[model samples]
Target: MSETSKMLWAVLGAFAIGFIVVGLSKQEESPEQKEAASMIRNYVTIQSMANQKCPEAILKQTGEEVYFPSETVSDKETYITLKWVGEKGFKKASCTVYGTLGGISELIIDDKVIIKKKI
Candidate 1:
């Protein structure tokens, strides 16, 4: 092959590899994203309970924090730990929430609950 043709093929190969990488990246979510989703769900659920005026005993646990989205506006990569207290039938259910604890609206779960911590 001519020198120019060889260079063209090399460039094409590089482009193909880059394309594959980008496509794969979009299809596969990072661990951070999964964690963020989990955190958002827990926070929203627990915040819901908090709004219901549940007993402090039900709200206090290993990972409990009063999350204020307004305070985290400056930092986009903030991580927060949230505690959700609740009861399911006879068993007690508590959730520990953590994620890219940045904004009140950034984290969304199933298009149902907005991450805005309900007062």
Candidate 2:
């Protein structure tokens, strides 16, 4: 092959790899994301069930101070602990996750045990 053709093939190969990387990354949801989503869903459900007993659930991401857009987090790479601190201290609900969308093994709000499943 001519030198120019070889160069073109090399560039195309790089672009193809880049596209594959981006596409694969988008399809895969990080474990931390799955955990956080499950945790948040649990939080919302408990809050709604409280129905005036508990206030809005405020997310407390580990290692984050505060920011706009659901508040930024310094640690978003790993499945760190998350707490849904009940607003105004009316209620507090937290969970020990079972698996990816596997449901919470335990949920405690206001020092009361809501759910506890066997290991």
Candidate 3:
């Protein structure tokens, strides 16, 4: 092959290899990151328990703050979304807390709210 052609092929190969290596390196999730994701999920689930009327306890345990986001209603039932914001990957989470007697709470994460509607 001509020298110029060979050089061009080598440059393209290097770029391709660099992209592959970077992608592989980023595919591995650190233990701390995994833990943070799990914590976020748990935080959302626990906040949903607030419908039972005592979310503060769970919030303290998780060390996450709950914020009221918004609400939606259907068939005379209301659903409330609540957001929990915290550390690492647990930066945001959404949960719904609904009451049988017409109480509603909303959890918001970013622009989305996780809702639980009372039936």
Q: What lDDT score goes with residue 2 in model 2?
A: 100
Question: How do the predictions measure up, each by TM-score?
Answer: 0.28, 0.31, 0.30
lDDT, residue 88, model 3: 43
- Please give the TM-score that candidate 1 achieves against the real structure: 0.28
Task: Let me know the TM-score candidate 3 reaches against the reference structure.
Answer: 0.30
> In angstroms, how far off is 103's CA in candidate 3?
12
Among the numbered candidates, top TM-score falls to 2
Clashing pairs in 2: none
1-119: candidate 3 lDDT, tens digit per residue = 99999999999999999999998888778899998887666544544555444245335445554445343222222334444455643466555554443333554444554433445
lDDT of each: 0.42, 0.48, 0.52
Error of 1 at 2 (Å): 1.0
Give me the overall lDDT of model 1: 0.42
Report residue 72 deviation for candidate 1 (angstroms). Answer: 13
Across 57-81, the per-residue lDDT of candidate 1 in tens digits comes to 2333312332322222112122332
Better of 2 and 3 by lDDT: 3
